[model samples]
Structures are given as structure tokens and as C-alpha cells.
Target: MNIGATVVFSVLFLLVTVLGFVAAGWRRGNLDELAEWGLGGRQFGTIVTWFLLGGDLFTAFTVVAIPALAFGAGAVGMFAIPFCIITFPFIFIVFPRLWRVAKQRGYVTVADFVHARYRSKTLALAIAVTGILALMPYIALQLVGLEVAIGALGFDTSGLTGDMPLAVAFAILAAYTYKSGLRAPAMIAIVKDILIYVTVIAAAIIIPGQLGGFEHIFAAIPASKRLLRPPTASGLADYGAYVSIALGSAVATVLYPHAATALLSSKSGNTVRRNMVLLPIYTLLLGFITLLGYMAVAANVRGMPEFAKYFAAYGNNFAVPALFLHFFPSWLAGLAFAAIGIGALVPAAIMSIAAANLYTRNVHLAIVNPRMTALDETRVSKLVAVFVKIGAIAIIFGLPVSYATDLQLLGGIWIIQTLPTVVFGLFGRTFDPRALLIGLFSGLACGTWMVAQQHFKTSVYTLHFDGYAIPLYAAMWALLLNMIVAGALSVPAWMRGAASFTGLSGSGDSLRDEA
Candidate 1:
């Protein structure tokens, strides 16, 4: 083992653990209430909200994967840059409304809003199931990132023995998260964001200086790997997958329950928007990080036989970690590893809590126990959070890292199915709840089937129409089918009038008034 790096990493991780426990009382409130424990008493201001949501947005999977993608595939991997760019505009336009509606209705989860809007426990349950299912793999991706970082620390990474360190790390994360609730991640995110910025900035300056310059780095990358457009059999550039994947990811980014959990914890709608305006600063940082991929290429990291084999076997997920070990001193590399681990832990804690909140509100309380008290609800959420962490660890140890990548890709496609109902729902309830249900299910089913048919290799599939192969994203097609089904069915429902619908409990004005 790289003892210096490992020791530094342990100390940093231990400090974060201590912070997590103390954060239970950071913004102390009634721990018995789900609103307090699950959502930080809904009291986070601009700065805290910025760090929390920023840390949640730029996760370990992102830190590790973006450069890994660039290292492996060239420009296509940089889709993350545009993905982050487009996301803020979308969030700014959409999330304030969601925040308003959610705050108005005392909704704790997105599923809660679905229940209030549709008045159908079944529909809300569907949303809850999708969120939970998508999140498990999502959280598993974080663990995979953590594992990769740990391996970079020169530890043994073979079989169950390799997973021992990860299990211990997550156990600490789960314990503190259970004690401090959202505040745990909220507090640690500060440290996480700080470490990430410092590490990336250091890498940005140091790596290129060590590798010559940008010109040399760009020139060194192979031509085929330079752009995002993939080549067809005829060697023509195909942009379908690149465009679709970027768009789909942008749409799906905020749909995750954790994103909603972080957003709802803000003090107000304006606080949510203001934080978003500043959130793009991380996108710039992300742009710098993606360069590590090209840097990895220019530095000829693959020239090392073992590192080359590892890259070939596991994909580019390890590029950043490998680069850190290759360039930095042992201690600094350990700090990088700790940063990645903390980055993963913060989001992992948030996601587990969000999934648990969904279960507690939409499943446990809505179906299992309508009379469950606030204190009981908080307790159930905490327990469910621990259970969710266990499931994520199980996924990590059970699946190969490559499969974890596939699952996260599939997750983006799956979660986007909710956008039609949730995002469109914010504008107006013109679309009938029944139509929304049909659309959501149709989109979800079609998207999943299309993605599965591709064997999880790519997000886009081509259809032979007449003589030409028309390429499209599974998400795009699924979304099209969704809108068609929804639009077709909703007309009759709209003609029948929203008032005739039992689920139409209130108008937009009424919802806003409740705020």
C-alpha cells in the first residue's frame, strides 16, 4: 500500500465522519419531523444550499467518469460539459415552480406532489418505485467510483477482500447519515466541494505543466477520439447518439430524488433559483476536469502495460485515479482519493435518504400506515436510509464496474420518464392525470425496452426506414411516444373538463396560495 496516501486519506475521511456526527445538531430542529430530518428543517440559505446542491450535482461518478470517458472515447465523453451547461438553464426555468408547488403542498418528495396533483396513490407509487429503482444503481455508481479511488491508493483490489474497505467506508457514511439526516451530507458537502475545487485546480495547473501544454495534449490525442460523433460502417460521422445522450442526461439530472431532496431543502423558491445561477461555476470546474482525460492520453498513461490492461478491462473510470498516482506524490494522491471518496459519500448519503423519504411518504405512510405519526415517519426514514445503503453496497459487490456503468446509463433513461408528468405538470394540469399515467408508463416501458435491446452498449438505436438507418435516442423515441399517447388521451379528458376529474383537487392559484 502507499502508506502516506492511505494515512492522509484515512485522516480526511475520519474528519468528515466527525463532522457528520456533529452536523446532527447543526441547524437543530425537531428530529421527530420528517421535514426537519429528511429536509434539514427546510432552512438552508443561499450559501449552504449552494454547497449542498452543488456537491449533490457534481458527484464522484462525475469526477471519476467524465475524465474516464474523455480518456477512452475523446470528445463524446465531454458531453458532460454541455450536459452541465444546459442543466442549469433548465433547472432555473423549472425548479422554482417545483419548489413553490412542493412547499405549498407540504410535499416532501416528488412522489408526494404527484399524489397531491393526481390524487391517485397508485400513480404516486409508480413514481416512487421508479425513483427508488433508478437510485439504487445510481448510488452503486458512487460506490464504484469510491472503489476505483481506493484501488488507486495501492490497496489490494481483488474479490471480496477488495470490497472490505468500501464496506467500512459506507458503513460510516450510513451511520452518520442516519444520525444527522440531510444535515450530515449537507455539512460534509462543504468539505467535499472544497476538496474537489482544490484538487481539480491543482490538477488543472500541474498536470498540463507536466504534460507539455494544451497544444501538445490535443495533438497527441488520436483523431478518432477527438470528436463526439461516432463513425458508421461507411465511416460517416453519426451525431445521433452524442446529441441524444447529452439531451437525455440533461433532462434526467434533476429528476433523481436526491436532486429534489436537495432543492426542497432550500429556504424559498428564489433561494433555489439564486443557487442555480451560481451552480454553473461547478460546470466550469467540470470543464477543467474533463481535460484530465486528454491529459491521460497525452501523458501516454496506457503505455504502462498494467495500467493499459486495467483500462482495457475496466474502461476509463480509473483514468483520473491512475493519473493522480502517476503524477502526484503519495500524500497528495491520497488526498485526491479522499476527495473522491468524500464526493461519493455525500451524494450516496443524500440519495439513500431521498429514496427512503420516498418510501416513507409514498409507500409506508400512504399505503402501509396512514396514521403514522411524524416521529414514527422520521424513524422509518432513517431505518430505510440504512437499508438503502446496504442495497447499494450489495450492488457494488455483486456487479462488475462495467455493469455498474450500464445500469447508471439505463437509470438516466428510466428517470427521464417522470419529466413529462413532473416538469410539464408544473406549468399547468391541462394534461389529465390518467393521461399522465399512461404517458409515464408508456415512456418508461418503451425507453427501457429500447435500451435493453441495445444490450446497454449505447443510448441510441437506429431503425431501417425505407432504405436509410435513422438514428435516435431511446429517450427521444420514448418521449415522443409518451407525448403522443398523452396528447391523444388527454383531449377527451380535457373536453370532459378537469373539474369532472376526481383528482383535480385544486387549481394553480390554489396551490400557490398554500405557499
Candidate 2:
């Protein structure tokens, strides 16, 4: 490990930590309010919203997983790039309506909106629990990426435990967030974007030259890697799994608690609308990162399909940094390492805060103590935010973990389950509350089973993606069944002219008044 580069990155990482604390002051006074700490006082303008959304979408998962895909599969990895394009139209058409309804009713979490829409706190609470459970692995994944990056930068990671680094990182994050609230991560996103662009563009330019250009590198990739495209020698075949994963990710991205956290924090519906347009460009950056995997191969940069394995070989999850270490000079690799390290912090901090808020608002305040004062809610939320950081730190000790391998399947399913509560409710549609609960149960069962079938191996059981041996992520299929069941059951009530379904509750304001 180069001592100079490691020293530079350590300094930069510390600087970011300090900057996080400063962000506490971005909006002064009364962070003790749940509305303020959890949602940045719901005051973020268009530019801040853009950065927050972009940062949330392009997380540590993108940093590690994209190149991991490219390293393992080749051209199939670009599915994420295209999926973003498809998802943009979905967000543009759907989210503005979501923002409008949420703003009108002062709804903070998706669960809040759902309960209002269908008059079922039970249904709303279930979705809330699933979201937090799903997001926790994701937050852990970011710390895994940071660990990889720091290790590769040549830090003395000899004594780091499975949970130690994550705990430290989370503690720092919790401090700033507790002090500054959502504004801390929101403010740091600017620096995060700057680092990402620098590393991505720098790697793109430098790596291709060292690799004998795209033409040379394309020839080297195996036929199995590209089901179609130029390099497949025998015939043109489509990479279905690659495409599915990409589209699945885009859909999953919107469903996350943090994605909603970022959106709900914005000051107006227009800000959310503007962000949908701007967020796609981050997908472009992701496209650039996916390409770096091929460049790494061209440079003979050693990286493994699994994040921990890759870190073992190269000591970091930063694909570009590893590539720089092998292909570029020592000094340049250090700078690239800085970008990757900074990149990890931006999204991880935001995600943990988002998850913390979910626990505090949707679960704690809503269920545990509904009559609690706003000041008390804020204090508990801040404290929970700290605990969330500490929890993340604990997970970090279990480093070299396959974050995507663990997270993608589960997170995808969890986020999609929110569609009914967040997306369907916006249009004033109510599925039968009982039916919705049944659908949620069915979806959870089917999705979890499908995922088990796709990947896990046991003496008695094995998961297979149909017959192909490829694991088709089950989130999409599970969600399909969930919505189908919800709708089909709902149709019965309309046809029978049931009294229960007729006087369906108005949005929460009316429902709360009734209660």
C-alpha cells in the first residue's frame, strides 16, 4: 500500500466528516421537530432535491455492483443504464402526483399515505416494517463499499473487525444528522457528485488508452459474456437476465425509503418533477462505471465477482481505484481512491438517516406513542438516528460481505410492495383493506420463495431461475402477484355493491377525523 495515497484519502475522509457536522447549521433552530429533522424541514429547493435524488439513486450499490456485473458478465451489465431511462418516464408521470398528495396532507412516510387511502393502519404499518428491514442491508452494503475502497487505498486495515468501521462511520453520520438533520447529507451530496464525476471521467479517459482502446478490449471479452453484440463469435443472442436486472433495479430504486425521504423533503411538487429529469444523468455516470470493469479486464486489473473477494484481491470495491492502481501511476490511483471513498460516504449517510427516520416516524411515533409531542418525537428520532449509525457500524465488521448478493433480491421485493400504498393511493383508488393485506401476505410469500429458489442451495432445496441456472430476481414476479391479488379481490367488492367498500375513507384528514 502506498502510504502517501492512504494518508491523502484519510485526510479527505476526515474533512468530509467535519463538513457533515457543519451541515447541522444549514437550517437553524428546532430540529427537535420530526417534520424538520426527518425531512430537512421539508424545505429543500429544486437544486438540493436534484442532488439528493441523484445521490440516493446512484448509491454504493452502483459503485461496487455495476463493475462487479461487468467483470462477471460483460455487455449485459449496461441494463442498469437503460433501466434508468425507462424508470424516468414512470417517475415523471407518477411521482409529481405522489408529491402533491403527500404535501397536501402533510404525509411524511409512505405508510402514512397508505393508511389514509384505505383506512387500514394495519396495511400501512406492514409496508413500513418491510421497507426498514429491506433498507438495512442496503445501508450495510454502502459501508462494505467504503471498506473495500479504504483497504485498497493501502490503509492499515489489519485490525478492523466485521462491525467496527461501519459503527464508526455510522456514529459520525448520526452525529451530523442529529445536529443538522437531513440537511447534513443533502449538503454533502454536492461534494459527492463532484468526486464521482472526476473519478468516472478520469478513469474512462485513462483506462481505455492503457487497454489498447475499445476495439482491442471488445475483442478480448468472451462470447458467453455477451449474449449478443459485436464480440459474440457464433451468433447474436440476448442477455435476458442482464436486461431484467437493470429494469428491476430502476423500479426498485424508486421504491426505497430514502428515495421517498429525499422526495418528501423537497419544498414543492415542482422540485420533485425537476429532479426526475435530472436524476437520469446519474445513470449516465453509472454507465461510465460499468464500462470501467471492461477497462479493468483490459488492464488485467484483478477483481472478483463477489465484493469481498474483489477486495481480497485488490483491497477495495472501487473498480476505478483498483484499475488506477494496476494501470495508472501510484499518485493518480491515490486521487481516484479519494473519489471512491468520498462516493461511499455521500449515499451511505443519506440512507442510514432515511432508515432512522422511518423507524422514528412510521413505527415509533405512529404506533408506540401517537399522542407524543412534536418536540419529543424529534428527540427520539435524533437518538434513533444515532442508533441506526451504530447498527451500521456493527454490520461493517462483517466486511467483504456480498452486499448486492444479499440486498438486491430482498430490497427489490420490499420496495415494490410499496407501490399500492404510495403509487396507487395517489389517484384516490382504494383496494379492499382486507384484500390489500392478503395481497401483501401473498406477495411476501411468493417473492421470498422465488428468491430462495433462485439462489440458495441446501441439502433438500435449491433455487433455480427456471431451467437456465441463472437466478431471475423474484421481486418483479412477487410484485406482479401482489398487485394482481389486490386488484382481483378488490373487483369482487365493486361487483357485489358491498356497503363496506362503498363508504371508502377519504384521504387521512377525513379518516383521522372519523377516528
Candidate 3:
């Protein structure tokens, strides 16, 4: 290890670790309550909410994996930019309503909202189960990001021993998150986001100069690696997969429990609204990140004979780290590495908290003990957070890095099936709980099958109309069929007057007493 890099990384890691522990007391409240522990007492304001959501939504996956995809597959990887652009606007439209209902009903998880709306344990359980499954792989992607960063610093991450440092880092994260709950990530996000901004700005300026310039970087790339669309057999531009991936990801981004956790932690519906307006600035950082991939191509980081075999064994996930180490001095490179590592902690903590909340509310308390106290619920959530972290680490060891990335993608597909019940169900009263259940299961099955048929390589299917192939994302296709079947099934329920059932149609003040 370069001593300068190692020293800087060690100091930064220790500082964040201490901050995590201290966060438990930052906004002192009833720590034994689910609302306090799971949702930060639902009291974050505009800036805090902004940082929390920004840190939660933009993870090491955004910084590392998206660019790695760009590095490897060119334009298809840049799906993330449009994906993010579409997400905030969609969130703006749907989330404030979710915020109003959740605050009013004292709901701590998405399942809580579903249960309040439908009065069906079955429907709530389905959403709870899907959230947990989707979040685990997402948490694992954080580990993947951390591992890539550590490896970039010249650490040996080749086997189980190679993962010991990661194991220790996560253990510390679990400890603080269990102690501080959502507050740990909420506080750490500030530091992580600051480091991320500085690092990205520096890279955008410094890397282009090192590689001659933007034009030279583009010119240096091979034809196969430079196309904005999928290259045809004759090297033509076909953007079918690009458009599908972008739209599919946008629809799915906020469905993650952690993303919802951030929104719910806000002060009011207006806070969520203002955040939707301001969050797109984070997307600009991502443009720099995607550009780093092209710079990696220009620098020959992956193609260089000396480094080729190592990255080939590791997957192109190491592209950004390799580029930084090659071009920057040891100390600055260490800061970038630390940014990626600490960045993982923010989302990892929130995801575990969100997953734990689902289990405690929907599974444990709802199914196992309906009379469970707020303290009991908090206890269960804290313990489950540890197990969730363990599961994420297990995923890292159990799969190839490339395959782990695919699991994160599959998580999106699985979770997006809940949108009809969660997002659309907010506006109207047509969906019967039973119909929603059927639609969710149908979407899960069809979407999983489509993605699996492609051997998990892509999230799209080709539709032939008049001898022309129109590629559609599996999630969108599954959602269309889901809505069709659900609408058809719910018509009978609507005719039976099921739409008149009592649910969460309350106002902001409806929950003031509970608060």
C-alpha cells in the first residue's frame, strides 16, 4: 500500500465511524419508538431531507457501476442519466401523497401504508416481502462498491481473507445503525455527499487534461465502445435497449424501501415536494461519473496489458478505481476511494433500517404479535438490521461482482411490481386488495421469467411487429400486463362496492394527535 493513501483512508474511515455512533443522540427523542428509530421521528427539514435522500438514492452503484457499464458497453450504460432525470419528476407527482398518508396514519414502512389503505394483512405482507428481497441485493451493491474502492487502494480482495476488511467495516456500520437507527445514515450522508462532490469535480477537470481533452478521449475510444446506441451488425445506432433501460429504471428507483425511508423522514409533504424540485442537481454529478468511463477507455486502464488480467478476473467494476489510481497522486486517490467507501455506508444503513422496519411492522408485529409495543417493534427492527447487513456481505462472497450487479437490477424488477398498489392506489379507489395481490404476483412471475430467459444479461424483451423488433423493458412490459389483469379483476370487486371500503383518505392534520 502507498503509505500516504492508506493513512488518509484510515483517518477518514475512523472519522465517519465515530460520527455514526454519535448520530444516535443527534436528534434525541423516544429511541424505543418505531417512528423515532425507523423514520428519524419524521422531522427532517428541506436541507436535511435533501441530503438524506441524495445520499440514499445515489449510492456507490451510481458512482461505480453505472460508469463501469459505460466503460464496458458504452452508451447503454449511460441509461442512468435519463433514468435519474425521469425519477425525480415521477417522485414529485406521487410521493407527497404518500407522505401525507404515511404521516397521518403513523405508518413506518410502505407495508404500513398498504395495510392502512386496504385493511388486508395479505396485501401488506406482499409489499413487505418484496421490499426486503429488493433491498438486500441493493445493500450488497454497496458492499461491491466498497470492495472495489478497497481493491483500488491496493488491498488484496481476491478471496475470503480479502473480504476481512469489508467484514469489519460493515460490522461497525451495523453497530452504529442498530444503535442510532435512521439517524446514523442521515448524519453521515452530509460528509459523504460533500466528499463525493469534491471528488467528482476534481476528476472531471483533472482526468480530461491528463487524457489530452474531451475530443481526444472520445476519439481514442474504439468504434464498438463509443456508440450512443447499441451498434447494429453493420455498426449502426439502435437505441432500443437504451430507452427501455432508462424508462424502466426511472419507474423503479423510488420503489426501494430506503428511498421511501428518506421521503418519510421529512417534515411534511411540502418538504418532499421541494426536494423533488432540487434533487436533479445531483444528476449533474452523474454525468461526470459516466464521462469517467469514457476516460477509462481512453486511458486504456482496462485494456492495458499489465492490468488486463486482474480486472478481467474482477469484472470491469474496478474501472473507476483503476482510472483514479493510475492518474492521481496517492493522497487524492485515497480521498476518492474513501468517498466511494463512505458513500456505501449511507445507503447500506438506510436499507437495513428500512428492511428491518418492514419485518417488525408487517411480518413480526402484524403476523406474530399484533399487540407488540413501540419499544418491542424498535427492538426487533434493530436486531434485523444486523442480519440484513450480514446477508449483504454474504451476497458479496456468494456471487461474482458482475452477477451481484445483476441482482441489484433484478431487485428493481421485483420491487416495481408493487407500483400499481403503492403509487397508483394513492389516487383512486378501483384496485381491490385481492386484485392488487394478483397483479403483483403476476408481474413478479412474468418479469422474472423475461429477465431470466435472457440469462440475466438484460432487462428487456424484443417484440416483433411487422417484421420489426421493438424492444421493451421487462419491468414495463410486466407492469402493463399487471395493470391490465388487475384492472380486469378489480372491476368485479368495484361492482360489488368494494371501492367504498375505508382506507387512508385522510388529510395532513388527520395524524397530528398521533404525532
Candidate 4:
């Protein structure tokens, strides 16, 4: 066991645990009110919101999985850099409007806005279900990241004994989150971001130097893995896959419940907009993080006997951890690992809370108990948050890490289907909720089938159009079908003079006007 690393990791982890609990008092609000507990009273300023959104979006999974993808698949993993860059402009434009409507209407989840806008409880329920379902694998991926960090410190992450450390860590996380709610993650995010920036910046400077240089790192990669494949007369399959993944992911990034939760916690629309401009700094960090994969390739860590078992066991997910362990001293390695593990807690906590908000507001309050009080809603959300984390833990134990990654891709596919309803619904009231619901289900079914055709192994599916073939993200294809169906159905309603059904004229100002 690496005693020095373990000790440092434990110490840093304990510090965060203490901070998580104390955060209940940091913002100082009534813990029993749903707004106070779930949305941090919508009071986070530019700096706090910046860290919260960063911690929420750039997760531990990104640290592990992106680099792992780079290590194994070459330049395709770099799709995340462009994906992130594309996301901020969307955020700068859309979320400020969303925040305005949600704030005015007291909407807690996207489902809440969908319900209020369309006045369809069933449609809102569908949105809630999709958000929760999409988040399950996402939260599980965070645990996978934490497990990798813990394993790097020489823990016996096998059988029952392996599950114990994860269980204990989550138990502490759940306790603090239940007591503090959004404030917990909002406060802890500051520290998590600091550690992540330090770790990434240090690695960017130190690792390449140790492994000869950037030139050597690039030279060491096999020719096949050096760049994306060029398009041919047969099709632009590779280019399509690359561009579609970037575009699809950018659209899907802020649609997750966790992302919504973080954005809604901001003090105002301006805060969300300011962060959008500043958040791309993280994209730069992601670029460095992706390079770790190439660094691992340059160092040939997978070929080393010491890391062979880790590669066999965790696959590419261990690339960053193994890279740190091989190059850095034990204390520094421990600090980096702690950054990853703590990174997991921040997002996992926020995601669980987000899912709970969806369930409590859109599902339980709307269906189970219409008369439920704010206190009752807060209580139920806190309890649901705990259960959500438990469900995520079950996923980690129940499925292999690769399955978790694949399921997260499927999550993106599933969540993006909500775009027409949530994002488009914000601009104007043209959609019939029934039509949107149908489009949502259609997209879900189509995307699932497409991914299933690949045996759940890849998210990109190729289409044959006569003699030409094009591969693209299944999510994008599904989203296209969703928009077409929703638009087609709406046109019929508009022609029939069923203005109410079409949401054509009077329902309240569009969210854009409110913004």
C-alpha cells in the first residue's frame, strides 16, 4: 500500500467532509423550505455560481473517462474540447431566459416549467422521468471515478471489502447533503475547483517534461491513433461522427438535471451569463486533461508490469491515476487522487439533489399529494436525494465500468430529447405539450434502438443513403425526428383554429421577453 498517498488522501478528504457539513451554516437559510434547501435560495453570486457550475459540469468522470478515451481511441476523445466550447454560447443565450421564467414562475425543475407552460401533468411527468433516468448512470460514472482514485491509493477494491470505502465516503456525503442541500455542493465546489485546477495545471507542466516532451508524446503514439481518419468517397462517416458528437454533446450538456440545478442556484440571469463567458477556461483545462492520455501512451504505462493488472481491471479509466502514480511523488499523487475523489462528491451531491428536485416537485407534489407543504416538499426532496445516491451506488456494483460509460452516452441521447420541450418551449408557446410528449417518446425509442444495434458499445450509428453512408450521433438523428414530429403535429392544430391546443397566442409572455 502507498501509505504516504493514502494518508494525504484521507486528510484532504476529511477536510472536505468537514466543509460539506459546515456549509449548512455558510449561506444561512431555512433548511425546511424547498427553495432554500434545493436551490440555495437562488442567491449564489458570480464567483460562487462559477465554481458551482464548473464543479457540476466538469465532473470526476471527465477527468477519468475523457483521458481514458484519448489513451485508447486517440483524437476522437478530443471531441469534448469543442463540445465544451460550443456549450457556453448556448448557455449564454438560453439559460438566462430559462432562469428568468423559472424564477418568475417559481419553477424548480425543467419539468415544472414544462408543466406550467403546457398545463399537462402527464407531459411534466415524462420530463421528470427522463431527467431522473438520465442522471442515474451519470451519478454512477462519478462513483466509478471515485473508485479509480481510491484504487490508485492501494485499496482492496474487490468483492465486499472493495465496496466498503465507497460506501463510507458516500454515507458522509449523504449526511452533509441532507442537512445542507444545494448549499453543500455550492460551498464545497469552491474547494474542489481549486484542487482540480492545481492538479491539472501541475500535470500539464510536469508530466510532458518527464516523458521527453510534447513532440515525443506525439511521436510515441501509434500512427493509427494519431489523428481522426479522413473521409472518403464512400462517406464522411468519421467526420460526421466527430462533428455530431461535438454538437450533440454541446446541446445535451446543460439539459441534465444536475446542470439545471446549478444554473438555477445562481443569483440572477447576469450571473449565469457572466459564468458562461468565464467557464470556457475549463475547456482549456479539459484540453490539458485529455493530453494525459497521450502522456500515458508516451510513457507506455499500459505495457509496464506494475500497471498491467489495473489496465486489465479498470481498462482505460485508470490512465490518469496510473500516470500520476508513475510520475509524481507519493504525497503529490495523493493530492491529485484526492482532487478526483472530491470531484466525484461535488457532482454526485448536486445530481442527487437535482433528481430529487424533479421527483419532489413534478412527480410527488403534482401527483401524489397536491396539498403537500413547502416543508413537506423539502423533506421529501431530502429523502429522495439520499435514495438517488443509493441507486447510483447500486449501478456501480451492478454494472461494469464500461457499461456505466455506455449508459452515460445513452443518458445524453435520452436527455437531449427534452430539448424541444424545455429549451424550445422557453422561447415561445407554439408547442402542444401532447405533441412534445409524443416527440420525446419517439426520440427515446429511436435513439435506444440505434444504440442497441451497436450492442450498446458505441453511440455513433451510420446511415446508408443510396450509395453514400454517413455516421452521426444517434441523439442528433433522434432529435431531428422529435422536432419534425412535434412541428408536424403542431401545424395540424394551428390549421384547426385550436389555438389553446397549439399554444399559439395568449399564455403569458415568452421566457425570452421576460429575460
Sequence-dependent TM-score of model 2: 0.87
lDDT of each: 0.86, 0.70, 0.87, 0.91
Clashes of each: 0, 10, 0, 0
lDDT of 2 by residue, 1-515 (tens): 67777776767768778888887777665677777777888889989888777677776557777787687668777777788888877878777777777788877777777778887778778888888777777777776667667667655454645335545666676677778878887888877777778778877887788778888877777766754443133322244345556666777778788888888898887787787778778877878888877776665655344334445654324555567667666666666676666666667666767777677667887689988777877787777767766665555454435544455456667677667656777776667777888888888888777667645321011234434333334666677788899999999876765544445564666556654
Q: Per-candidate TM vs. native? A: 0.94, 0.87, 0.93, 0.96
User: Is candidate 1 or 2 superior in TM-score?
Assistant: 1
Error of 3 at 192 (Å): 0.5
Model 2, position 482, has a per-residue lDDT of 87
Give one digit per residue, the lDDT tens place, for model 4 in 261-309: 9999888999999999899999999999999999999998888899888
Candidate 2 steric clashes: 10
| RMSD, one per candidate, in order | 3.9, 5.3, 4.8, 3.4
State in Å the error of residue 324, model 4: 0.3
Using TM-score as the measure, the top candidate is 4
Which pairs clash in model 2? Answer: 24-180, 148-316, 161-397, 162-396, 162-397, 162-398, 163-397, 166-393, 167-393, 453-463
**Candidate 1, residues 288-329: lDDT per residue as tens digits?**
989999998898887777586556655678788878888888
- Give me the overall lDDT of model 4: 0.91
Q: Which ranges in model 3 have alpha carbons more than 4 Å from their true place?
A: 229-237, 498-515
